[model samples]
Target: MPMLGFLERLKFAQNFCKSTSLVSLILVIQSQLTLTIVPLHFSSSHILIKLSISALLLIIISGFSKCLKRLFGVSASAPALVLFNVLFVWGMHLFVIQKAIPSAANVGFNMECVLLMIGFFSILASDPGWVTDDCYGLEGAVGGTVSDAGRPCEALEVTAELSLSGGSFATRRIRYCKSCKRDIIGFDHHCPAFGNCIGKNNHPLFMVLLVGFLAVEIAYIVSSTQFTKESAIMGSALLETTLSGNLVVSTMLFSALQVLWQIVFLMWHVYCICFNIKTEEWINWKKYPEFQLPIQSQLGESYSEMAFINPYDKGISRNIMEFLSSTG
Candidate 1:
C-alpha cells in the first residue's frame, strides 16, 4: 500500500509539472516582451509607437490569416477579429489598467494573458484528426472506390451499423471536410476564432481556449471596474494615458458581452461533453438515427413520440474521460 501511494504521488507530481510547463514558458516570453516593449511604449514618440504597434498588428494578422487561409480556406476576418480583441484587452490591461492596480495583482493578470495565448495558439496549431489516404489499408481487397482523398475503404469495411436507443440503428458515416479536403474523425464544427475545424484531436484544446477567454474577460471587467473606482476616489490623472476613457469603457462592455455569450456556449459544451454529443450532432439530431429514440405517447398504441438520445453516451465520467483521451 505504501509503495502504491508513493507511485500515485509521483505520477501526480509529474502531471502537475507537465501542466505548468506552458505557463512557465509563457512567463519567460512575456518577460522578454515586456522588457522590449515597455521602453518603446514610454520613451518613444507617440507617433512612432502608434506606427510600430499598428505595423506589428498588421504583420501578425497577415501571417495568421495567410496560414489559416492556406490550410483551412478561412478568410482574414476570423483571425483579424479575434486578434484585435486579444490585442485590445491585453494592451489595456498591460498599459492602462495595471497602472491603477497594485503590482502584486499584475502577476495574476499576466498569467491570465498567458493562459489565453497558450490556449489560442495550441488550438490553432493542433491537427483536428484529419483522415488521410494513408489511413486506408493498401494491401486489402477493395470494399469501396477511391474517395476524394484517393483513399478507398478497405476490405474490412470502414462503415459500421451502430445500435441506437428504442431499437433504432443507423450506419455511421465518415464526415469529409470540404475546407481541409479531408475526412475528420469525431468532427464537431469549424471555428472561426481558431480558423480551424474542431474535431477529436483539438476539441479539448478548444474547450481550454473558451475557458481561458472566460477567465481573462472576467478579469478584464473587474480590472476596469477597479481602475474606474480608483481614479474616481483618488482623482488621479490616467497614467500614461494613450487610449481614451470611451475606448476603455467600450472594451470593458465588449468583454462583458463576451462573458455572457461565452458562459452560455461553455455550459452548452459542458452538457455536450457530459453526454458525449458533438455540436454538429446536437444541432442536426434529426439527421442521425442514433440521436432519435422512440417514446410512447399518451394517445395510446397508435401514437408515438421521438426524443433525442445520444447513442454514444457512456455515462458522464467515462464520456468525459473518453473525450479527454481522444488522440484522433
Candidate 2:
C-alpha cells in the first residue's frame, strides 16, 4: 500500500510537469503565429502601432530585472514568466481562434497568424542564445554563460575600460568565435538576423528588435478587429440567423483569445520595464556577477537612455523619404 501511494504521487508530479511544459510550448507557438500573421496587414496603420508596442515591451522586459530587484525586491524571472503568459494567451486568440475559422478577412489573418506562430516558436525553441559576429561581437558580456565544446563558459566581465571598447573582460581565458573569425571581447555568438554579435555594443539593438516585434503585433490586432467587425456586418444574412449567430460566436471567441494574449504580453513587458533584465541574464544570474551587478555599474557611455525608438517614420518625413528612395 505504501509503495503504491508513493508511485501514484510520483506519477502525479511527472504529469503536472509535463502538462505545464506543454502549456508553455503551446503559448509560445501561439505568440509566434500572431507575429507571423501581422505582416500580412503591413499596409494597415495598426501594424505600425503593434510594432511600436512590441518594441517598447521588449525594451521594458530587457530592463525588468533591475527594476524588480530595486523596487519590489523580487526576481526578474517572476515578471518574465508573467509576460510569457500574457503573450501566450494573446497569440492563441489572434492566431488560433481568429484564424481557425474560414472567412475572407479571417483567412488572411489566420494565414499570417499561423506563419507567425510557426516562425516565432521555431526561433524560441531553437534557443539561439546570443549571436556573435565581427560587426556585433559577443553576447551577454555584462553577465551570462554558454556551452562551448561540452564545457560551460562564463559570461564576459564588464570593466570600466572594457565598457568603452564594448568588449568583455572575464576571468576565463579569451577564446575565438569561429563564426566571427576573431577573439570576441566577451565572445558570445553571431546573430545572422542583425549581422552582428549580441555583445555590449548590440544588446540595445537586440532589445529594439524584440520591442518592434511586439508593437507590430499589437497594431495588427487592433486593425484586424475593425476589419473583422466590418466583414461580419456585411456577410450577415437576416434569413439565416444561424449563420449570423455562428459568425458572432466566432468573433467573440477570437476577440477573447486576443485579449488574453495581449494582457499576458503587456503584463510581462511591464514587469521587464520596471525591473531591468533579460531572459538570458535571468537564467544564469548566479553564474555571472555581471547580472548581479547594479544597473548603474553595467551601463556604459554608449548605453543610450533613449533605447526605445519608433520603428517607422511618419508624416512628411515618411512621404519624402519614400518618394526619394523609391525606384521610378
Candidate 3:
C-alpha cells in the first residue's frame, strides 16, 4: 500500500484500503441487519434497541480508525472480526438485555461481554513483531542459515563486533522471519488472516482472545437459547426471548460454529503451553534433532551426559504461570 497518503502516514489506520472497504460494506449492510423479524407495533423498547445499535455502530467505526492501524498492522480478517464482534454485542443488548432474558440480564453476563471485546481488540491492535529490511544491510545475505550480513529468515551469530568504515558497535543475531521479510524480536508464525506475525510478545494475547471468544459463546448460548411461555412478553415474536425473533439467532449460531473451531485451536495451544514449546517447534521437531549436553561431577570430572532438554518447561504449573505472566 502507498505510505505517502495522509491516512497511511497516520500508522494505526490498520490498512487504509481494507478499512475503507470494510466501512463501506457495513454502511451498505446496515439496513438489512436491522430488518424486523416479526410484525409488531413500534414501542419504546424498540426505540431503545435502535439507539443501542447506533451507539454500537459508532464504536465499530472507531475501531476501524487510524488509531489501531497506525500502531499495529491489522490482519486480513481483522475488519470482519471487529464487525462480527460489534454486531454480536449489539444483538445481545437489543434482544436479550433489553427484554431481560431471565438470568441473561445479570452483571456476570455483562462482564463476559466486556471481556469479549477486550480480547478481541487487544489481539488486533497489538504489535505482532514484523521483520523488515532494516535489520540487515543491503549486502547481507537473506534467509540463508550460513552466516552473512543479511540473509533470508536467517542471521549470522555475531560473536564480536568488527570495525567498520562508518563506525563500530556491538552486534547480535536476532530472529529472522523470511515470510514477513523482516527480523522479529521473537519470531513465531505469520498469520495470513491477521496480516502479521504472532511473535513471542503477542502470542499470549492471541491465546487470551481465542479462549475469551469461546467462553462468551458458551455463556451466550446457554442463557439465550431457551424457548418458553415467557415468549408471551414478545407478542407476535416467535419465542419469548429477544434471541428468538431477531436475526440474533443467526449471529448466535455463527458464534457457536466459530467457537467449535476455536475450541480445537485452544486445546492445541494449551498443550503447547504445558509442554513449553511453540507451534513452529512442534511442527518441525523431527527436522531439528536434539543433542545432549555434557554433565560434570562435583570434582569437575565428566560424570554423565544430559539429554537434550526443553529449557522453557518449568513443570506444568510453572509453565502455565510463566506463559500467563509473559509480556507476550
Candidate 4:
C-alpha cells in the first residue's frame, strides 16, 4: 500500500511537470513566431491589406485559443497574447528603434521583461491555497467521500482549529469553485490569464505580476516616442509609413490599449487589498453576511444594507504589509 501511494504521487508529479513545460514551450514558440512571421509577410504590405490580414489573424487566433483552452485551461489565452506582444515590442525596439539611437532604456526594458517572465512562471507554479481533501477531513469529514464521478464530493465548510498554545483560534471559510470543481481557501477567483485560482496563497504574486505588466507597458509606450517622431519627420501618413514605422506604431497602440485597462485593474486590486477583501467578495457582497449591516431608511424601516464590513481588515498599513510580505 505504501509503495502504491508513492507511485501515485510520482505519477502526479510527472504530470504536473509535463503540463508546465508544455505551456512554457508554447509561449516561447508563439512569441518567436510573431516576431518572425509578421515582419516576413505583412511588414511592407499595403495598409488595407495589412488591416484585412490582421482581422483574419485575430479570428484564427481566437479559434486556436479555444482549442488550447479545451486542452489546457482558460489561462492559456492571456499568457500567450501577453508573451507574443512583449516579444514583438522587444524585437521592433532592438531591430528598428535602437539602430537609430541607443539609450539606457534598453537595459530597463530588458530587466522588466525578465521580471515579468519570472513573476509569470512563479504564479503558474505556485499553489493558490487550495482547499484540499485534507481540509475536508478537518471539517468533520464533510466532503471526504468520493462521488460517483470518481472525484471528491463538492462542498463548502467553515473550519476552525485551536492553536498549539490553545489561546487563540483561526477561522477560514472554504468556498467551492464551480469552474475549478474543487474548494479553495479564501477563494478570490479563477484568473484565466494566470491559469490558476487567485486564492489566499498566490494573490500577492498576481498583484506583483499586474504591477510588472503596468510598468512594462508604460515603458514600451514612452520609449517608442523616438521612433514615432522619426517616422513623423518623413511626412507620410500612418497608413503610408515604412515597415519599421508601422510596426512601432502598432506596438504603441497595443501598449496604450493595455495600459488603459491595466490601470483600472490595478486600482481595483488596491482597493481590495486595502480592505482585505477578494474580488469575489466585492462582487458578491450581498451573499456574504460578513459584509452586511442593518441600516434604517427614511421611513424608519430597517434592512440589510450589504455595506462593506470586512472582519479581516487590520487597517491599511497592516493590510498592505501583509499583502506585500507574503512569499507566495
Candidate 4 residue-wise lDDT, 41-143, digit = tens: 5555664554455545545755776787788674344545565567677777778776555568888787888888888867764567665455435434343
Model 1: residues with Cα > 4 Å off, grouped in runs: 1-75, 138-143, 147-174, 233-243, 293-307
Error of 4 at 32 (Å): 14
Q: Local distance difference test, per candidate?
A: 0.62, 0.40, 0.51, 0.63
- Candidate 4 lDDT (Cα, 0 to 1): 0.63
**Superior candidate under TM-score, 3 versus 4:** 4
Best by lDDT: 4
Q: What is the model-wide C-alpha lDDT for candidate 2?
A: 0.40
Give stretches of model 2 more than 4 Å off: 1-17, 21-104, 130-152, 165-328
Scanning candidate 1 in windows of ten residues, the lowest lDDT window is: 164-173
Whole-model lDDT for model 1 versus the true structure? 0.62
lDDT per residue (tens digit) for residues 1-328 in model 1: 4465357446534543452344333432332233333223433345345335434544564575568558876443444356556766888789778888878788898988887876776666466765545545532332345645543432212222334322121122245555655566677887766767888788888888888899888988888779866755223344543334434544565566668779999999999899888887778777666567778777557777789876678899998998888754
lDDT of 3 by residue, 100-162 (tens): 465545556667677766765555545664434444553253333534644533543221122
Query: What are the RMSDs of all candidates, in order?
Result: 12.1, 16.1, 12.5, 6.9
User: What local lDDT score does residue 44 receive in model 1, on the 0 to 100 scale?
Assistant: 34
